[model samples]
Structure formats: structure tokens, C-alpha cells
Target: MKPLVVVATLCALFTLSQQAPSKDKCMCELTNSEKAFPYDKLGNLEGNAVKCNSDVTSQKARKLQSLMMGLERRLPELAKDIAVLDSENDEQMYAAISLQLINNELWEIQRLMDELNSTTLSYQRLSASATQQLKGMRGKMGELEAYDSMQVVKRQQDNRRLTRDLQECRTGHQHIVQPTRRPRGACPHGKFDNVTGPRVNTAGEYPGSYKYGAWGRDPRPAAGTESWYWRVMLISSNKYGHYVRLYTSLSSLIVGVSTPGNILISPSNPTTNTIQGPNAVMYDGALYYNCYNQDSVCRFNTSTKTVTTVKLPAGTRYNSKSNFCILDECYLYTDLDLATDESGVWVIYTTAQDFGNLVLAKVEDTEPPQLGQPRRTSVYKSSVSNTFMVCGVLYATRYIDRSTEEIFYSFDTSTGEENFNVGVFLHKVSPNIISLNYSPVDQMLHAYCDSIMVSYKVLFS
Candidate 1:
């Protein structure tokens, strides 16, 4: 029965992970329990991707990734699908569906196996694990052939929901379209041209102690604090913070105003609802940041003193799995960047499905808050130093030197066109820009660079 459970769950999750990525993936408290599902042996499937040979194996590994994306979605449906199949008096249909599930996967494996036999350089494909999976699959193939004569496919479809789902697992992996383009929205502030200045640069009240965090003005504020600015310093391991400091104006943020208004995430325990990573954004009197120790976003309303959350995709990389990096070292806990632009608020991060390429999700300004249609980008997350969205376009920057940063790439979510040479350079007051945020209302790009806060005048065309 243990083996029966494993086999049925695998096929079911393959069906579940495919139930439409954007529309269905907002686990939002309603589906939090599903996040605890364990992958068990299937966890090692991604390990094979790392062992891929650059020639033929690389192409096949990508194919496997596509199939796994479908698999990851249905994975949560594992238990229910298993119950559907396991309810039978006898689990005779197991071998048939296993063959259906493993067939397409075997085609890719068999191709690598052919390559292994032909080239001496492909010795890694001949490992014991690979050989065993192939051997077991071949045995299932022999069993599946007899089921064809028995009209098993037609019979299974007549009575159970699990049958069609198992069949989808066999065929659904091949035709997934590239989700690179996003529908263009209005960019009233105009297209980005250049950014000037380290206009207001200074280490705040904490001085050089806090090296990584985010500070910026809320493009849409509550009432009369249009000139007000906010700062969130990642005081714990450059990754977590328990509070956000508020300044009445830009001068106060630059001069380190003492007794600045402070908002604590939790009154009883500072660690609860603490900010995670080097990036966060304050919008409409609420603070949005990566939820502490979880792959979800936490929204803390300053006025109500209440919190709400939105969970990212199951495959989203968090807790520093995909952070910004340069040639020297990577920034820790710099995953899940929150940005504000002329259009609205958005979150930028990467997922395993996109092969770790950057993914963007628009955050709606509702009471409980919800995630909008997600758009995928071709840019790799770790390849850039920081990112900010302006007028619905995402711009990525990389480290240059202590006095400069280069805006080298841009991805327009509206048309899915990628421009590799934006070539806009930003003058810096400090070496590293840990967090970069664009505020549409003021038309300013605020940067938190190595304990210093700086603002720039964004020049648009």
C-alpha cells in the first residue's frame, strides 16, 4: 500500500501542478496547508538537471524542466488523486498509469542513454540510479502492453476522474508556450530615459551598521504625507528587520532625524512579521515585504495595525535561493523585490518553472490583497545586482565600481521585448546598492546602498 500511495500521488501531482499557473496559484491562507506536501524521492529530480552535459544533455534537461513545471503544479493534488485511485478493491490500474506517466519521460532518458553509449564524455548518464530507473520503466512497459489489448484506457475513462488526469500527465508536458510577454498597460509618466544624481546621500541614524535595506517614498500615500519617506533596514544578518522608520520629509531621511516615527511588525514579539531580505516597499500606508522564514509576502497596514499575506507560486525561489549577485559575492536574502511605478505595485522574483528567470506579479491594492496575472522575463535573477519597475517596465542593474552602477538591461512587460543595452549609469555615494525602488508620484529613484540612502531624479522621454 505504501508503494501504491507513492505511485498514485506522483501521477496525481503531475495533473494538479498543471491547473493554470497564475489564476490558481495564490495559496492565500485558503490553501496554506497544501504548502506542507512533501516531495520525498521526487525532490532529487532537479538534481539530475545539474549533472547535464552541455551538448545534448543540456537540451534534454530543459525538456525535463518543462515537464517538471507541470508536475510541480499538480503535486499538491497528490493526496486526493491517490485516494481516488487507491479506493479500488484492487490497484490493477497502477502499472498502466505508471507506464502512461513515465513514457514521455523515458523518451528523453532514452535519448541521453543513446548519447551515453555513443560518447565517452557522457559517462555520468550511466550511473546506477539512471540504469535502475530505466530498468524499472522497461518492466512497466512490458506490463502496459498487455493492458492495451484489455482496452484499459477506455475502461478507466468510463468510471473514474483519475484516469483522464493520469493521461494528461502523459501528454501535457510538450506544448507549454513561452510566457515571456505581458500585455502593455498605460505608462503616463513616459518611457525611461536616464537617472541622475546621488542627490541626497547619507547614512541614517543607524549609520554604517546596517548595510542592506530599502528606503523610498510611497507613490500613493494616505493623506498629507506626500513629502514623507520610509526606511526599512535589514538589521538581522542583512536579511530581517522588526520595524520601519518614517521621516516627515527628504531632509529628515538624509540628516538622520532622531525620534522618527517607528512601526513595529509585532507588539509582543519583534521577530513576528519581521521584514525579510534587502528589499521592501511602503505603499498606501501599508508595508509590503517578504514574510519572515516563508515564501509569502506580508502586508502590514500602519493605521489598522493589521496584517495580511499573499503566497507566491509553489516553485518560487526564496530564503536566498535566488538573490542578486556580481563577480565577487551574492547579496543574502535579496529575493522577492517589491517595486512601485506609474501603473501600480509589483513584486519581482524568480521561480523554478522559468528556469530561474525573473518573474513579475502585480499586487492589487485591495483589503485582503491579491496577486494579478504574472508575467515572465528572460533575465536570470542572480545575474543582476538590483531591479526596479518604472511605468510597467522592469529594469535590471549590475555592479560597476564603488562610485557607479549601470542600468544595463530592460524588459518591457507590455510587449515582452527585451533590450540588453539600456546603458544608463547611476552615480553612487556608496559602493553597493542593496535595494533600489522607483516612486512614480515624485518621479524619483530612491536607493539604499550599503547603509546610505540616496535619491535620484528620473529623466523620462
Candidate 2:
């Protein structure tokens, strides 16, 4: 009976022990929603509640309650930290966007600066070019003004000389017996041959339209051949400069090959040493040309390769306004009207003292040729392009076109009479004839058209 009572007591004790909760086994079942309690409600801990059964001990529940209270206290700080982090992230995004905008504006500014620099450079270049052109124009105007003033003074002096000449003629008429008129020589009539001569090669060194030229028999030729030579002056298009080249033809003017030789005269001083006009002539062993803008004649000796200048009288008209004006503008300057006669070199010029009459002076063939006293005649102002001598008679030519020129005036040195009945025509090989020269040996007319040298044999009638 005692043993059975003890077994019952043991069973009762086991039952009581099982009924009470063990410390290690005091865990309670949580609601399905409360399983992820602390982590899920981290952002809003105050609004979250953890649910569990009453099987848990009072001590364990109290500890868990303390922990939950501590978590509740930290909820506001966590929320504040999150708010600060969001604010910081927003600030970083704003900074990145602002940086991109500033970079775009900087790039646009740089582009504008580059364009402004390019524009400034172009403007500077244009300004420099315009300044240079203005300077050139001013210089040309000054020269033109000087030329006009000279012409006015010359015309005034001419009027006074004419008054004196008329007075003298009337006073001498009563006392002087009328002289008998001398017999006149027959006028020269001729037709030109058809063929053109060889072209003159100047190596394109002195490139431009031909201005002045001279052709004649070479005073010094090799052995027995009659070598003829030509001197041509080319004016640069700029109108401020000129160059002279010597050309030689081995055969006669009837048929010949022409080649350019040495440059006899160059622009030594471009400002002052320009050749005047188509007034160049070959005499003896020298070439004579008028020096533009200067009162001088330049003589170049072919043998010595030396140049000598002879002074002309002051106030002598030899500039562009004085002669050789082919165009209406008359921008080209020419003054000395040089012609070769049977006697020697003759210069036909107009002086203020001669009352605008043409004066013909014979030049002595001395070292520096001496100019004789001029013989004044009635004014021959009919735009004489060129002058030549045939059998002691001086004939003047007038340029018409590329195909035609006319001989319109003539003067007889022996009889001192001027005739204007000339209607002779020159059939030109080319339209642009800058100069004309006659060769007595071959009876041919030599014409310089641009760079070409053309010749026409005369059929005298």
C-alpha cells in the first residue's frame, strides 16, 4: 500500500512539473503578422505592436517589455536619421544638376569667344588693306593736281608769246618784200605688204602693254649681216612704273626672226625714272628716251652699256598730260616728240615761249648732243601718234584702230611749209599699235603691238 502511495505522489509531482513552464522552454507563439516585428516596423516603430501568448513567464515578459520600451524610445531618432539622409540625397542630386547646367553655359560662352576672335581678326585684315588702298589713291591725286597746274601756266605763257609774234609779223610786213614760194616735193603714197613678222619674246619678265618703242639699223653689226634692233618700253598696269627691253632681228625687215635681248633701261628709281612716252629713238650707237616727270632725256649706249642723261629746259612739257594720249582719259604721260631726219636727231616740241606752236630743233651728234636754236612754226596740234622722216620730209601718223591708222600731217624742212592733205592709211597687223618706226633700208614700217613685232613693206607709188 505504501509503495503504491509513493508512486502516486511521484506521478502527481511529475504532473505538476509538467503543468508549470520551464525557463528554457518559456517561448510563446506569435501572430503571423507579428513574426517580422522589429525589422518590418523599423521606419515607424511607434505604430507597431508585438503579440504573444500568456504562457511566457512574468520575468521574461517583463524583460521583453523593457526591450520593446527601449526600441520605442529609439524610433523617433531613427526616423530623424532617415529624414536627414533623404535631405542629404536631395542636396547631392541638386548639386549634380547645377554642375551640368554651369558646364553647358561655360561651353556656350567659350564658343562665342572663339567666334568673336575670328571676327576681330578678319576685320583687322580688311582695315589694313583699305588703308593701303587709300594711301595709293591719295598719292595719285597729288600727281594729277601738279600736272593740271603746269598746264594752266603753259597755256598762259603761250597766249602772251602769240601776241608778240603777231605784232612782229605785222610790223615787218610793210618793209619786207614778199618772197617767192619754193617748189614742194611730191607726197609719198604707199601700200603695205600683207605678211606679219615674228613675235618678240621678252620671257614675260616685263609683262604688260607696250608703251614706247624704236626700230632702226644697228650701227654695229656682226661681220657683213645688216642686223636690225628694236627698243620697246612696257608700262606696268599699275601706271606707276615702266621697263625697256632691247630686241634684235637677224634678217631684214622684209623677213626676220625677232628675239628679246638685254633690258636696256629699268626702273632705277620707280618714283622718278619712268620713261615718258613713245618718244624713244635710236641714233648713231645710242638710244634716246624721255624721262617721265623729269626734265631730262636718257641716252643709252649699246656698246658701252652705259647711260647718260641730258637736261632739258625748265618748264618743258613732257609728262602724261603733254603728249601721246591714246585714250580719252590721257592717263599715260608723254612729252618729247623725237624723229630721225636726214640731218641727224630732231626733237619737235611745244614751248610756252613759242605761243603753243610746234618747234623743231636739230640735235648735234656730239658726245652730249647740242640742241640748235628751234624753228617755230604754226601749232600742229592734231594728236600726232608717231613721226618719221622720208627724203627730208617729216610725216605724222594718227592712230585709228587695230586695222587702220592714217598719216594726216606732214612738214617740209626744205621749204618750211606744212601740209594737211595727207590721207595715207596704215593697214595694221594688230589692233594695238604702241609705236611705229620706219626703216629706210628696207622701206618697211615696224610696229610694236603688245609683245609682238610686226613689219609691213611699203609699195611706193
- Which pairs of residues have clashing backbones in candidate 1? 13-74, 13-75, 16-73, 16-74, 17-73, 17-74, 184-414
TM-score of each: 0.59, 0.49
Q: Tell me the tens digit of each residue's lDDT in model 1 across 206-249.
A: 87888988898887787888768898887667778888889875
Clash pairs of candidate 2?
320-333, 402-431
Q: State each model's CA lDDT, in order.
A: 0.74, 0.54
Question: So what's the TM-score on candidate 1?
Answer: 0.59
Residue 427: error of model 1 in Å? 1.5
- Top TM-score: which candidate number? 1
Candidate 1: 10-residue stretch with minimal lDDT: 33-42
Per-residue lDDT of 194-234 in model 2, one digit per residue for the tens? 22222222312333444435444533334543555655554
Every candidate's CA RMSD:
28.6, 49.1
Query: RMSD, model 1, all Cα superposed?
Result: 28.6
Q: Which parts of model 2 have CA positions greater than 4 angstroms off?
A: 1-216, 219-225, 238-244, 247-260, 266-274, 326-331, 400-402, 459-461
